[model samples]
Target: MARLQSSGFFDLGDGRLEYHFVGRQPAAAPTLVLLHEGLGSAMQWGALPETLARTTGCGVLAVSRQGYGASSPVSLPRPADYLEHEARAVLPRILDAAEVGSGVLIGHSDGASIAALALAEGEARLRGGVLIAPHFFVEEVTLSAIRRTRAAYERGLLRTRLGRWHADVEGAFRGWNDAWLDPGRRGWTIEAALTRLTVPVTLIQGTEDAYGTRAQIVAARRSCPPGLLTVRELPNVGHEPHREAFADTVAIIAAFVRRVLEDEGAGEPHRPDGAPMGE
Candidate 1:
């Protein structure tokens, strides 16, 4: 895998956003765009994105959402409306600036939710997606994990460790933490929005995920069109399947990309509905 560093700023309707590109593959090769977890950043993905790109012979684009990593920090409270901004505003600008024609989106945790919403919103530019440990609805385990993580951030080692990579660790936590824990946010659900996505999708989750349950996975699959959904449940894995079961996770992504590419007949991959793949 190659290590490449690149950053760009693009203006969304609300404000400017920044993103980081990890690896650039042959133009003819597929592109793998990564959307990090809630408390994650480009650097936090560690080497998974690079390894996946190398294994699949594709480019890797890992973004630092508006308030995380090297991007601008969140100056205000993140509301339920924020996910819409991500689906409609931030993503398009990043894709345009990167000049990514078509690609697979690999999203983890909160990133998974954003990816689902993005697909639900419909983008002609994306081929398909790999959603890992995603949440479509609030679960007890999720609330428990958030509470535990909050405690860790407040008095445990998590904050110190994560702060090493995130320039605005507080902003990162606030954007995700406050929104989910808000009493009024318990009803937040993306199932309705996700059901509209007609793209081929591979949902990856761990049987032992600390933050979500099987029901979340069921909801995600049920939201998709029949025959367009694939689910991989890794045993003894947790929230970060790509890291906990790195080899298996990489293999799954490689297979999905290959399947889509082959179905494209040496051209662009297509959605389950037979729409051309690309942005």
Candidate 2:
């Protein structure tokens, strides 16, 4: 199995971003780029990076965007179009900095929305995407959940927990929470972005997710080209399916990753146990 190649902060000129790279990308295989949730960082990804590298024989790069993890904090009251900005402006720079020749993005929550937007706008190196609990548009459930989270943060419960991972926990929380709760953002939607996807995409969502409902899934199905999209809804699971159902999530992702690589003529992916993955 490939070992951790490096872990440190990458200077983006304006600010440094934290990153953890596992394994080296083989000439034939695409790198798996992990985009964390709103409040997540490289460290928050836990064992997913290493496990993905070992299972798929591919490199994995997990990055923490500005205002999260050990990265430099951003000014509060982020713009409503921040997700679009990240997708079009920030993500390309990150991909360039990482020197990712070819990649598959695996994103969760806010990161998933960014990934979808990036794919829609077009990124040359990106072959496909695995989006977990992505929000295509604003919903009452999403606003209500953020309000409850805001209450928890105000009560110091959420802050204390998130403090363990972020150096500026307040910035991380407020940046995400404030943006979502912005009344102007009530009309926020990436459904138009979904319609522009040229590459294949796999969307994974949990039926029990409090932040979003099946309507999000319905939006994707309605917008994206039917042949290019795949959907998986897990029963009895929540927003963080990777953490809530690790093995199952990994299996599903690995299968899709292999299919993507195979379509690129990169060859089959093997299980950590050394057996070839079934189609």
Candidate 3:
């Protein structure tokens, strides 16, 4: 039998956000919540969500955040702590509305950063996380790459390509592009919050990722420790490892989720707010 696919919008109080489920109806297992890159969306994930669900026996829920895809358009120029706010407040609301009580987060680029922040702040429903090319702190390479992206958007290719995935293409581009380029956002870093993360984390980065460096992997490893952290570096790949290395990425994600479920089943405690218990 063919699996089902469906899409919908959630009224997140602040605004509406678009989301889709590619595999099971109610989203299964500790649902694999997939978060998109800055300019990417649920559709932009291509077949990965469905593939992940099949590979891991979990439901894959992908959301288009605030200003991307079929979601509401932004007013331009998001705040520096935009990701933090989403992680701390908005994510829980979305999850509650969707009726997903627990999940394993798989985040890419900006979405990855949001995953890290959410975990760090002790989001209790999160069993673990798979962060791909996540940035804890601002880096020159990231800013530079984003600047180039803005130039490309201005030149047309970036926007035109983004249009296929986003309903408000300009809002998607400028919201992410403008925030990172803002000088005030340069001081942004979740390094301190990282130490508070108790659940396991898997960090996947490409050696050739222009937006970030191995420094992110190194830092996450240092803070999260050996048992709690897993690092995977794909050689000769760029920003989007999941898109660029689909087969390998799915394999890693499936294995990581299995490990997390095993560990949790053994009775690792969590707080009332859903954050993992202890550091």
Q: Which prediction has the highest TM-score against the true structure?
A: 2
- Consecutive 10-residue window with the lowest summed lDDT within model 1: 270-279
Candidate 1 versus truth, CA RMSD in Å, comes to 5.4
Whole-model lDDT for model 2 versus the true structure? 0.88
Write down the TM-score of every candidate: 0.89, 0.94, 0.90
Better of 1 and 3 by lDDT: 3
Q: What ranges in model 2 sit over 4 Å off?
A: 1-4, 26-28, 270-279
Error of 1 at 196 (Å): 1.1
Cα lDDT of model 1 by residue, 1-279, tens digit: 332346565555565555556544425456788888888887677778767655665678887888887777776588777876787778877777666677778899888888888887778778788899988888877998999999988994988887887778888887888988888878888889877887788999999999999998789767777888899999999889988998899889888987876675546543333444342
For 94-149, candidate 3 gives per-residue lDDT tens digits of 77877676688999998998998888877778899999999989999999999998
Tell me the tens digit of each residue's lDDT in model 2 across 33-138.
8999988999899889999988787778888999999999998889888889889988888877777778899999999999999999878789899999999999
Q: Lowest-scoring 10 consecutive residues by lDDT in candidate 3? A: 266-275
> What is the Cα root-mean-square deviation between model 3 and the actual structure?
6.3
Whole-model Cα lDDT of every candidate shown, in order: 0.78, 0.88, 0.81
Clashes of each: 3, 0, 3
Angstrom error of the Cα, residue 263, model 3: value is: 1.7
How high a TM-score does candidate 3 get?
Answer: 0.90
